[model samples]
Target: MSLELESASVEQTQEIAQQIARLVEPGDVILLNGDLGAGKTHFTQGLAAGLETPTVPTSPTFNIMFVYEGGRLPLYHFDLYRLEDADELEDIDYYGTIEGDGVSVVEWADKFEDAQPDECLAITIRILPDQTRVLSLEPYGGHFEDIVAAIA
Candidate 1:
């Protein structure tokens, strides 16, 4: 599908994420990009909240990956900031999480190029002045396209 972009505040960003989450099924991957403090985690919080797992979802930076299971589908939150290489994924079961029965939201996904799964939603958030954001969503596959369309 064509890439979808929008301007949003932190709350609007979360609401958009929630709307998108309504269409996601299990085993979905999200590839996110933005500079520091681009509201990536805020979008994830909206996604988890939309999934009915309304809670404070952390960065998972130190933990590498945080799995939240109290939603309609499980949520696998991965932060790759401290990750040196994608090769270390095997040690932490990256493939397992991406191919498993859950929704995975990955922050700083630029570190993994060819390693990213085929079925993934790519997002880029640009921080604007005055606490606003420019967010773009590029769905990479048919499944993700459908989800994007639904949310759009």
Candidate 2:
């Protein structure tokens, strides 16, 4: 199923994501796809906050991934923007990490199809001519369907 929502400001975008974060469970995978400066990291910051992580989250564009613990569950934030190939997933143990404990939120997920999880909440953010953000959420599996419904 799918749901689309609009955000007039950065905080609104984060608020929308925070709703999802509240309902997230360990093993939940959220794949984020958006152009540069589209607020993917901003959404993640809200997610970390909802998960109760201590520090604010930053874009993992260079490091590829960052794990935030001490929250309700660990937050595994990843950025595939700098990756050239999907095979590089192994370098970061992408599968092992996402399949392990905690929730995984991957930015630039559209860049590598193979990096996507079998079941996940896929979010696409589009910037309108007025600079508003349109976030579309599509769930790929049963577990995520309920999440979508709850957030919708």
Candidate 3:
């Protein structure tokens, strides 16, 4: 199943992220696709809130990945925008991170679709001319379908 939502402000986007976060579990992967300044990181911050993590999530562009513990489940935030190829994912141990006991959120995930697992939640954020953001959630497996249903 899929879901399309509109966010009039950053807070709304975060709210949507939090809603989704509640449905997240270990071994789950969230693929985020959006342009620069599309609020991917903001959405992540909300995920951290839903997970109840002590540390807020920030853009992992420079660091590649940031692990947040002490939440309902750990959050492995990854940004692949700076990477030129999916092969670089290995350097960061991408597979290991996602397969571990945490929920992985990958920004610029469209850039490395081939590297993504078959079952995952794919979210695309599009910025409208009026500045509102449109978030489209596409679920690739049954687990994700349930998440979408709950969000709906």
For candidate 1, report its TM-score.
0.94
Q: lDDT (0-100) at residue 69 of candidate 1?
A: 84
Q: Global lDDT for candidate 3?
A: 0.93
Instruction: For residues 1-152, write the lDDT of model 1, one tens digit per residue.
Output: 75655655778989989988898888899988999899999999999999998566888989999989888999999998898977888888988888889999999988888778877899999986776787888888899889888877
Name model 3 segments beyond 4 Å from true.
none
Candidates 2 and 3 compared by lDDT, better number = 3
Residue pairs with backbone atoms closer than 3 Å in model 2 (clashes): none
Better of 1 and 2 by TM-score: 2
Model 2 ranges off by over 4 Å? none
Put the candidates in TM-score order, highest first.
Answer: 3, 2, 1
Write candidate 2's Cα lDDT for 1-152 as tens digits: 79999999989988988899889888999999999999999999989988889989999998999999998999999999998988899999999999988999999999888667889999999999999999999999998899889888
TM-score of every prediction relative to native: 0.94, 0.97, 0.98
Q: What's every prediction's RMSD, in angstroms?
A: 1.3, 0.8, 0.7
Per-residue lDDT of model 3, residues 11-70, tens digit only: 999999999888999999999999999999999999999999999888999999999999
